[model samples]
Target: MLHPCVVVSGVLLSLAVPTIISMESCEFSGMPGMPGIPGLPGRDGRDGEKGEKGQPGRLWQDKPQKGDQGEPGVMGPSGKRGVVGKPGPKGARGHQGLPGEPGEASHTDATQQSAFSVARGTATMPGRSSLIRFTNVITDFNKDYNTETGHFRCRVQGTYYFVYHASAEEKLCVVLKLENTIVASFCDHVQNHNSRQVSSGGLSVYVRRDQEVWLETGDYRGMTGKPEGYSIFSGFLINAH
Candidate 1:
């Protein structure tokens, strides 16, 4: 160890008081302090991985629109025919109708009552209405003709057919009448002055019930003779309305 006070060769040496070296003895030990500035931000992190698949959601309400129409279906087969039903009961008879009016002429018989007369001789007066008695009543249906008066009083309303025959000596003229109306006339002259000539006639007239028909030969002169049934008057009802 070297003493501080020791000197050699006439020189003085001294020592400082601090025992060891400190930072204060270095170059910048007494400088003032200052805050540090912030640095730039770091880069953003990468995207995360995908999550698990979710469950199907439930329906909340009905759909608003109508569905589209389907195509038309095929036609069905026809059904079999059914059996016939039973017959119905008979109906009740209806009431009788009103009585009908009289029928037509076809309803009457073709062969009906007829009238006839035959005469002998009856001279008639001229300018006066006269009746020649048809002396023989051959057929007088309904007893309507009068042989004594030479008149046929009709008993039924109908169309009637009439006929007459007369024979005379010399010359004889006669007129036929219905009631007061003259209908026909006949004239006959003598043949060979003795054999006698004949005349005849026929007519269809409408005769009402109670009307009269007769033959008159008294006009101008009178009828002379009669040849049995040749001189006759006859009538019949042809039809009735």
Candidate 2:
């Protein structure tokens, strides 16, 4: 009758012998029960494994603190035009100027002394362009020659010379005018009508101011005066414009 497995092993050895004698009779450890109410923040942690690349930082040697003037960059396009230079050296010679205020006395040197010489004191026979009346006055200096209008009045205005000499008996041809323009001529043709002949002439002319100059007779006038000889007329003023 005790074969039910020895009655369950004697009821589990009498309940494990009173729980091992109540944990060996409990000797000290009983007041730690007031820190148990904070447990709800633990669900975000799963990503950490990738780090290896750090070693290259050392080149800033002290001149790297000038960086606050950077806002002016956009204007560059205009450069190429230069080549032309060579011409210098030549200047030296100037100093000699002061000697001028003394020039005002030449109205042709105050009317440059005109001149004349005349002769013809009787026996005249002038006709045909007539005007040969030189009534004797040897040298009329500045009297401008005019023994009663045989004309020569050109006060002073240039080169003049004029000359004449006549003494005739039968055919003479004279002429030396200026206002009617003829300039020079003289002839004497006396084939012995009791003999006498002399006709001379000269000229230079360029007279102008009152302008007259004269001595005419073209178609033969037979001029022979003063003791039957000597007839003269002259003019002077060489240069005086």
Candidate 3:
């Protein structure tokens, strides 16, 4: 009930108790005054209530110093094609290589010699597919046989090997053409017309460049030539193409 600053601090404590008892009987103690002008900065406090989540810090074991090379990471979308890897164990046979620069001289079986044989000295009877003239040359290496065009021309261009032999006495049917296309044939039905039958034949074709080959005679011409029996026609050149 006595509040006006507590009744003015009880009347200044009874007037400062007789002026501190007359300054404690007056003596001397004075000189200490001039220091007071610094007081206006204090009003900012209100923020304190959110503090409970702090126990997770121990993971720094020291391996992190390789930095400075990073500017290349924008090319990553092409990576899904990788399942074909099983063919790698057969590679050790290589060291024999440096001897190559010397070519361009081929074709030599004596320059791809096309051969021939020919025969038929006189006993002709060729009509009914004609062409059997073969005069007689036993072995004409490059003449390519043409005893007045009985044909064997193929100036060398493939597998030849033709052959023939006749010596008949009555019925023979030799054939062996190539451009006219009969390939090969030979027959002899000489039931002993005094005995003379030799007929033979052969094949292996594929001639090309000029291509002729002959020896006809289908409706039996009975070809027996020379003195009494020899009628050949051979050919050669078994590989060139």
Candidate 4:
């Protein structure tokens, strides 16, 4: 036992000496690698604080500001006129015309072919003698005679003419009978020894148409001269109005 204990004590002492040397070297070296770079510069700092509030104020001083002017607006329309006035006056007149000529006649002249006769003691004479009367050709004849002096008148109105000539019997003379009396006469005896007496004249008579007219013998009172009595014959012409 005593012999090995001495060998063992020698070995443990030799091992403790090396471990102490390595630890000492590591401690003495100061930390091992290079140092790092520095950081960027910082931003500028903020401004200072606002000012303090003002005191209370009036309404006029606190009023809002005026807005900008607007574009121009459109224009308005015109008004109507009042009522009108009264009427005007009239114009002048015109001129006149010229005169005209005379007019023509309607009826022509009429004539009888032969004499109309009034027999002795006869009241009415022939009808066709009315043909001389342009008015009526159908009526009776108007006649008159005087025992004193045989004469006649034209009662109707017209232009009358007489034609007288003697027959074989006696010296011929005529009296105009109208309106129951004698208006005219031709008692002058024959100028020649020959038995025929002839006379004619125009008379303007104012008798109405269709009225009567006649001729008859004369009353020879104072005559120692010729044949015993006078025979009458006559024709007439009538013109119308």
Best by lDDT: 2
Model 3 scores a TM of 0.26
Best by TM-score: 1
The per-residue C-alpha lDDT of model 4 at residue 198 equals 36
Question: Listing every candidate in turn, what is its Cα RMSD in Å to the true structure after a full C-alpha superposition?
Answer: 21.4, 19.9, 18.2, 28.5
Instruction: Give a tens-digit lDDT track for model 4, residues 121-207.
Output: 222221321211111122224332222232334443456554433332234344566655666765555446544443433344545
Query: Which scores higher on lDDT, 3 or 4?
Result: 3
The residue-by-residue lDDT of candidate 1 on 49-136, one tens digit each, is: 9999999899879778888999999989998999999999999999999999997767555334556555544443223346666666
Per-residue error for 151 in candidate 2, Å, reads 20
Higher-lDDT candidate of 1 and 2: 2
Model 1 clash count equals: 1
lDDT of 2 by residue, 1-241 (tens): 6799989999999999998988899766788889989999999999999999999999888876777888999999988987877877877878989999998885545458788888888786777768889888889887888888879889888998988888888888998989988877777788887887787878798988998988988888888676758788888988887
Compared with the true structure, all predictions reach lDDT values of 0.68, 0.84, 0.83, 0.43
| Candidate 3 C-alpha lDDT tens digits along 1-241 | 7789989998999999999999998877889999999999999999999999999999999998998897887776887888998888888798888888988987656757778888888886677667788787888887778898788888879998888878888898888888888876777789988878788878788889887888888888888685868888888987888
TM-score of each model, in listed order: 0.47, 0.25, 0.26, 0.27
Poorest 10 consecutive residues of model 4 by lDDT?
A: 131-140
Relative to the true structure, candidate 2 reaches a TM of 0.25
